[model samples]
Target: MGTPHSRRGNTRQRIQDVALGLFSERGYEKTSLREIAEKLEVTKAALYYHFKTKEDIVISLSQDLCGPIDELIAWAGTQPRTLATKQEVIRRYSESLRASEPFFRFMQENQAAVRDLAIGDSFKERMHALFGLLREPEAELTDQVRCITALFSMHAGMFALQDVEGDPEEKRKAILEVATELVTAANPPNRRPVRPDSAQTASP
Candidate 1:
């Protein structure tokens, strides 16, 4: 038999996966806990044991996504603020966002719900922290835009390119390439040049 810890984790992940599917098919507001439980073929009581409410479900999902970003921020904090560090930040961030395409779609469709839940505020704070790591305080406005745009390109690419009809991993690499170029170009020429093979080992 599996450990109790693994069993509990499986149940929570199942609930989250089912809830996200319902949220995407039906609007977030329209999807109910009873509906989620019914679809899972599990009892309402069982669902409640894991998630008390729909907001709780979203909070749990957001926390899972934010945890890595928070760790990335903490990791970046210890490293010197160089272009390589910034590139690693972009790489790790792209990796973090890869599995969150469904969540991104939910956020896009439920902007009002996202705002009401304060998910937007929490995500914005993390972006600000990342921006701090990507650019120096004294950087010019254009360079600042470059850094922000680079991050945004990676975030937007997953959603924007979903329908483009090609290999998903390749698309991610292409997007990462563009974002990396933006950051590299934003840096001074005196800085070391970015390696051409950086994208291959970017997430590795």
Candidate 2:
């Protein structure tokens, strides 16, 4: 048997998953805490032990989805700012988005509700931090736009490619490729580190 703490953690995750599904299906505004508890086959009191309100559930879900992003931002901050690092950021970001697709879908489908929620501002703040990490302060306007577009491409590709026929992983790869290209273009040749092999080949 699982320990009491482990069991409680499982219950909390279950509540988050079921709540997101209900929120997606019925719309965040229409979905209630009671409905989520009913879907989970648990009592409202039991659900209350985990989340007191629908907004609380959404906030918890947001935190869970955004946690990896926060970590990525911190990780990027510690790395040297280079084209290679920026591309890796794009790759890792795409993976993070893949893991949290459902939460993102909810945000896309329920724009008004998401805007009204506190997570909206929080999410935007994280994006700004990420953008700062990707773009140089002295970079040209066009290059800066490329960095921003690189990030936007990932989000757009997730939903935009849904109706198209292709493997999901393949689509993600294609999106990552485009995002990588954008960031690479944004980074000038002067800024990219010279590979040892390239340097050797160029030697007389």
Candidate 3:
């Protein structure tokens, strides 16, 4: 047989996966950690190694959930602010948000719990940082608004997309495409102001 350690790792992951499903289905406040332990066929002590309280489970799930989005934001920070770079940012962000759909459902269902935990503030800051990267400080008000709308559209699109027909992946791609187009239009070369130094332009 394979190593007991490997088997134990699998069981722990399975427990977490099952717990999140139950939490989402029944609502986090209504779902008990003991019930999760029972459903996973593991003793409570075994589950405790991975999660102490039900809140701990939700916290852990949220962390595992945001890891990819954090990584994408980090990656985007290192790229140039050209159209291609912006497009990739939108694509990766859409994919990450798509991956986070379950956590979104959890947040919607457990709004009170999430608010009590104050998890929303940090998430909003992360979003502002990402959108800040997408916008030019010198951009016109309309352009800045376009940037804001484009960024939020990617986030809100995932939730709005649930009822749309066809493949979920295709819908996500379309959302990214729309966001990328908005960013591209807002950053057009002509609208971008040239510095007074006349470095890239003929002398007046």
Q: How many steric overlaps are in each model, in order? A: 0, 0, 0
lDDT string for model 2 (6-90, tens) is: 4355889878888888888889999988889899899999999988888898898888788889999989877778788888889
Best by TM-score: 2
C-alpha lDDT of all candidate models, in order = 0.82, 0.86, 0.74
**Model 2, position 5: C-alpha lDDT score:** 42
lDDT of 3 by residue, 69-152 (tens): 788777777665666676677777777777667777777677777777646666677779778767887889988888888988
**C-alpha lDDT of residue 142 in model 3:** 89
Considering lDDT, where higher is better, how would the candidates rank from best to worst? 2, 1, 3
Worst 10 residues of 3 by lDDT: 191-200
RMSD of each: 7.8, 7.0, 6.0
Task: Give the clashing residue pairs of candidate 1, or none.
Answer: none
Candidate 1 lDDT, 80-129, residue by residue in tens: 66788888998888887775666777887788888888678998899899
**Clash pairs (backbone) in predicted model 2:** none
Poorest lDDT segment (10 consecutive residues) of candidate 2 = 1-10
Candidate 1 is scored at a TM of 0.85
